[model samples]
Target chain A: EAGVTQFPSHSVIEKGQTVTLRCDPISGHDNLYWYRRVMGKEIKFLLHFVKESKQDESGMPNNRFLAERTGGTYSTLKVQPAELEDSGVYFCASSQGHWTGELFFGEGSRLTVL
Target chain B: GIQVEQSPPDLILQEGANSTLRCNFSDSVNNLQWFHQNPWGQLINLFYIPSGTKQNGRLSATTVATERYSLLYISSSQTTDSGVYFCAVGDSNAGKSTFGDGTTLTVKP
Candidate 1:
């Protein structure tokens, strides 16, 4: 079985530009998560999805950030009008279930907004 | 939301040595795990121990949920073990995880 895989290992965009990061979770995994780690900061959760429906999005930083998982498969996170502060490593993870399961993380997408 | 605090923020040791890393959560019912973020930045699952103790080779983790704390033990550590160890506690009710800043361990050859 393959582990979680993220696209465009790294991305660079100018301020006010938009960028989308993609994540392909492990097969048959229903729980997908989006998390970010800004420079010198601990990793923080952004949102979660169970199948195609969002289970929790309490950690989303602002309205400019949007995440979606279509057909309960791959997921994408779009950061619009990216700010310099948006520069960080975006990680996607998957688990077999929403509770009491180990998480499998991807290599992470490093976003640099200048 | 739960708060997680990892102790010793950093550690450096020689190969073949043993060490213990600690994590304290504000509160937890179940669902806790230890992850090792390798040099390439992949978060690898080390243990999913929410209670009691579980051992796997040179790595073992013990979670005393009642005391709201956990311990990760590395025995006869190797260079490959150098990485950041994170402890995440999930709210059994919400299924959301709260991760600590992490304990960074550097092993010397």
Candidate 2:
């Protein structure tokens, strides 16, 4: 079975620019999650989607960052007017259940805001 | 939010050596996972051991949910085992897993 897959393995953009990262979870997986890891920091959760509806978004850094899962299959994280601190690796994960299953992560999208 | 802490922050082991990595959390958790982030930046799940003990090949993990701590043991380490191991925990009430800084392991061949 295909695991979680992310697009634009690496992205480089100027400060204040916008970048969108995409993730396609495994088939039939209803639970999707987003996490970020800045240089020298631990991986932190960003948000979660159960099917097309957002389950939780308490981890979103600020108003400039937005995430959406349209049809419950894939997800997109967009950072508008990105700041220097936005440079890091963004990971997407999926599981069969909320807190009862193992999570599978993607290769991660590395964003470099110069 | 729950706090997950892993130690010792870093470790170096010989190919034939064995080592244990530890993780401590601040509160009760219904989910606990151990992951290894390889040099290529892929976070691979090793175990979803919320409690009890499990072994896979030369790697094993034990979680003491009552004590809010977990331990991962790597036996007969290999050069390919070099990577960052992370511990993540989540409570049913929060619905999100909190990760630790991770234990960076370097296995010398």
TM-score of chain B of each: 0.97, 0.99
Candidate 2, backbone clash total: 0
Docking category of candidate 1: medium
- Ten contiguous residues with the weakest lDDT in model 2 chain A: A95-104
Residue A3 displacement (Å), model 1: 1.6
Q: Model 1 captures what fraction of native contacts? A: 0.60
B1-109, model 1: which lDDT tens digit per residue?
7899998899999999999999998976578889998998778889988899999999999999889999999999999999889988887777568789999999999
**Shift in Å, residue B27, candidate 1:** 1.1
**TM-scores, one per candidate:** 0.95, 0.97
True contacts kept of each: 0.60, 0.72
Q: How many residue pairs clash per model?
A: 0, 0
Q: Model 1 Cα displacement at A74 (Å)?
A: 0.9
Extract clashing residue pairs from model 2.
Answer: none
As a whole number from 0 to 100, the lDDT of residue A73 in candidate 2 is 85
Worst 10 residues of 1 chain B by lDDT: B89-98
Interface quality of candidate 2 as DockQ = 0.77
